[model samples]
Target chain A: MGIVNVKKDNFEDVVLKSKEKVLVDFNADWCGPCRMLRPILDEIASERSNVKIVSINIDDEEDLAMKYGVSSIPCLVLFDGGKEVNRSVGLIPKDAVIEFIGE
Target chain B: MYDIIIVGAGPSGLTAAIYGRRANKKVLVLEALSYGGQIINTLKIENYPAAPNISGFDFATTLYNQVKDLGTDIKFEKVIEIKDGIEKEVITTKGSYKSKTIILATGCENRKLGIDREEELIGRGVSYCATCDGGFYKDKDVAVVGGGNTALEDALYLCDVANKVYLIHRRDEFRGEEGLVDKLKEKNNIEFVYNSNVTKLNGDDKLSSVIVTDKEGNDKEIMISGLFIAVGKIPENENFRKLINLDDSGYIIAPENCHTNVEGIFVCGDARVKEVRQLVTAASDGAISATEAIRYINERK
Candidate 1:
């Protein structure tokens, strides 16, 4: 499956209630580095079956971003069993994502 | 195991991929961020031999395309650790790859403006890369801190985008090229803040101003939306420090050649100990390290 674009409406079902591990990417449309990171995250989403990749636009879901304490764009927060296991800030490579998810 | 695993996709790493692929080795390049590295932020590179005054983006694209044509596999990943042995295990954030030889070209990160709330307000209003975040401050005031070519270039680039640009430096004299300094001086919106340093970043949730202190210990707060820290960079060798010998400043100690303390692991570019760090020198190191790595692999075979 491809990466999922998340919003406030269905975030509870798709992320909090999901069975598999979730990788939530917090980003904005105007962020240049965030744009660069999109394709890389998509590539990872395509390759990984154990983990689910999703993106939450901070502009659209400001409350979700504030709850997560994401001070930077392109922030990746890994959640397992409905809890945050790890998080990374800034635009890091794919290996970092794998490492962040404890894979 | 593959023949070679090159870390980083900067000028040095990309150059290595070109050389390694030509030698008929299965080369894999793992990059932490974008393929272009720091040069992608550079506006114009005037001295990159035979390609005078070429844009950094164009130069990196050409090199990346050349490496792709040669069949060198490029992976975007952040390498977390390296297990050295007969067959090296290069562990990244995403996955692990084994290779006979490893090229450690993982480059440097922008030196932070270590001050209050600076780290906390990274994307809010404080940024290190002008090219990446300059658009956000369009028609707004921004301050760039540093005395190097990158600082001067950032100021020049921001002059076109931001309504006002403050070039903040600790010393009165700039270490950047005379041409760039002159160009920055010509920009109508650019203001020079000589012999001063940014003491603190002021604002909550978002940066609204910065406290700049001069030589006389006088503090002046400048109201600006963005603060671009262009103050050079530090080697990003924290992850591989356990397996490699590094200098006091955290640069990989490759003294003369690219060969590290490990037999099969070699380092090149700004990540390694060196007197000068430039685009041309980084490419040169890439060629040298790839050649040395190739020889090592050949002798083993």
Candidate 2:
């Protein structure tokens, strides 16, 4: 599956309640690095069937951003069993992202 | 082995790829992060010739595509080390490759504000690129630290979104353009804190305030939701230090011809020690370095 856009209303069901490990990308529309990271995440989403990918637009979901302590764009947080196990900030290559997710 | 292995996907490296491909030589471009490098953060690139008012992202994307269409192999990998010899070996985090020639255009990264808890506070309240994180501080107070064009631009960009912006610089006079400084002076929401430095970052989970100390040693605490650091950039040439000679500032010590101390290894872009580090000059270095690399390979044969 492709990257799922997670909003406040569906964030819990789409991200927190998912059975597989989810990689939540905290991003914004105006951010250049965030836009650059989209294609890499899309590739990951397609290749890794066991994992899930979701994106949160901080502009629309300000409360969710605050709740997650996200103060940067392109912040990737890996969630396993509905808990954030690992997180990486800023733009990184695909191999580094895969290494960050421990896949 | 590839004819040319360019280490960096910025304007200089991408431009080198274009030149190398046009010469009908196998070229591989390795980049650790996203393409475009620091230029991607720039909102408007007015200085680049013929591309007036074009966004930096657009220029970089076009160049990237142009190189891609030419069949230049671009890999996203972090270069850890390089072995210099007749056949140079370029090692990356993922894998390694051998090339007849290598172009080191790694470029520069944001210089950090060396205060306590600065690294820990990243993404919490501190950011290097205002264009990337300024949106998070909408209607909230923020501070910018630097005295260059980037600092002034960040202040101007943040002034429109944040409730208030405090521009703190170590020197009283800004090193940025007079026009940009003048533009910043006109903003009512932007306040200038001259001859000062950020001494401390104050917050637990996130940043709430910063301690700014002036030349007189007087400390002033500025309450803000975010701090954008535009102090300038430092070269990422540590990995290549053993293979190449670097100046005190860690920039590759190369001549105007872009040839390094080691043969078959050329340096270009912001990574090289030069006075003017603009887009045009970088592209110019790319062409010169690629041409030199092509000549070197032909002479070897």
Candidate 3:
């Protein structure tokens, strides 16, 4: 499955209410690390079928970023259900990303 | 076994890979985090000889591709331990590999404030990279702590986006370039807080204010929506402390030749003790370390 670009409209259904484990990437266009992370996330999305990957542009959705207290870009928050289970800040490698999701 | 196994795929390690492969040696680069190291977060790299005005991401990607095209094997596994012997064993989080020579290029990481609730406040009010998190504090008051080039650069960048910027340093003088300090002085929105250190972080859910203690032990509170900490960097050489010699600050004790105390193990980049830790110097170290490793391998053969 392809990575999902989430906004306020589908954030609830695509991330919070999803049956599968979700990895929501909080990012911005101007962020260099966020740009570096895009291809890696795409690779993960293509390889993994059990987990759902989504990207949320904080600039477009300020309210959602604030609600999640994500002051940092390229922040990866893993959601098992409707709640945030684990999070990793800043840019990380593909293996680290997989380990994060597995944990 | 591979001829060389480079730990960390930053500029230094990647450059070493290019050199190692060009010499027809089998090379493998194991990186814990993403390739490119700290340079990826940088917006623009003005210095670095011919690569002027190039974005850090572009530079890193080009170099990464160059290394890949050279037939160097790059793995995304964090090196956990290194067993020193004739054939060095490099152990990572996932698995292990044996090599004739090893290059320790594990770079440094952001130094934390070590203040109360600082860890919990990350992504709420505390940030390490201004370029990545400055947008969140747009038009909001922010404070940057540190006296190095990174801190000065962060303050300058934040001044454009933040309503007000407080550049706080523990010393009266800044260790960054004079040109950067001059540029910061011209910004009306940037305030220099010297001879002071952030002693406490205030707020429950998020940061609201920080208490700074001056040289005279006077405590003052500065209200801000964000705090960008760029004090300095700490070397990632703790894993190899048992196998290599490190200086007082934990940087690998390697001279300009990038030769570690161990016979075949070499160190390079920000992980090594150096006077100047710039991108160009890192590339220089990469070349030197690779050449040294090649010579060592040939002599043993």
Candidate 4:
């Protein structure tokens, strides 16, 4: 499946209440690195059948960004069982992203 | 298993892919960021041979297309770790794969100023790359921190876009070439802030001003909409620390010939510890590393 666009209303059902692990990408349109990172995230979503990939626009979701302490673009936060298990900042390679997700 | 898994799609990694694929070996290139590496940030590249004068963006695009047409697989993935064995295992954020040899070409990233709110202000007016985000501050005041070639180049590039550019350097003397320094001095809108460090960033939602401190403990607040940090670059080799040897500065310890501590693992580009880190050198290293990798695979067979 393709990546899901996450927002305030579906934050609970899409991310927090999901059965499988969820990867939340905090990004914005103007962020250059974030734009570069989009295709990579989509590739990951296509490869992983069980993991759910979602993106939250920081400009539109300032409250959620503040709640997660997201100060940077292209930030990937991994959630498992409704809790944050891991996260990474800046532009990184795919292997690094998988390692950040843990085994 | 595949023949080679090249990490990073910069000039070096792409160059290596060209060689590896031509040799009829199965090759895959994994890149974390954009395919161009640091060269994409450069506006013009005259030093690269045969190119005469070409924009870095065009150069990178041309090279990338060449590699793509060669049937070499290029994947955009963040590499998490590498496991060295008879068949090396490359673990990425997307998935894991095994290859007979691995070539590391992951380049360096911009160094941070280490000031408070610096990390928190990224994209919110604090940027390390001028070419990527300079347009956001068009006709607005901005500051660049560094005395090196990168910093000087950034300031000169911003002079045409930003209304005013503040070049902040900790030393009175610049480390860049004299030619560029002279050109920077000629710009009327560019102001040099020497012998000072950007100690603080002031703004709640975004960066509004910066407090630069001199060696004598004096601080001056400069109003600006953006801060371009070009102090220097550091190798992003933390992931391969377990599989390869690194220097004190975290650079992969491959003094020469792209030979790493591991038998089948090779390193190239800016990530390796070397005296010179340039586009040509990186491309040369890629050629050498791929050649050596091909030799290793043939010998094993």
Scored by Cα lDDT, where does model 1 land?
0.86
Rank by lDDT, descending? 2, 3, 4, 1
Candidate 1 C-alpha error for residue B268, in Å? 1.6
> Which regions of candidate 1 are displaced past 4 Å?
A1-35, A41-90, A94-103, B43-62, B94-97, B186-190
Per-prediction DockQ, in order? 0.21, 0.70, 0.72, 0.14
What DockQ would candidate 4 receive versus the native complex?
Answer: 0.14
Runs in model 3 deviating more than 4 A are none
What's the TM for chain B in candidate 2? 0.94
Model-by-model lDDT, in order? 0.86, 0.91, 0.91, 0.88
Candidate 3's residue-wise lDDT over B91-154, tens digit each?
Answer: 9889999999999999898888787798888887899988878988989999999998989989
The better-scoring model by DockQ among 1 and 4 is: 1
Q: 1 or 2, which is superior by DockQ?
A: 2
lDDT of 2 by residue, B56-133 (tens): 778889999999999999988889999998999999988999999999999989999888899888899999988778
Name the weakest run of 10 consecutive residues (lDDT summed) in model 3 chain B.
B234-243
Candidate number of the best DockQ: 3
Residue pairs in collision within model 3: none
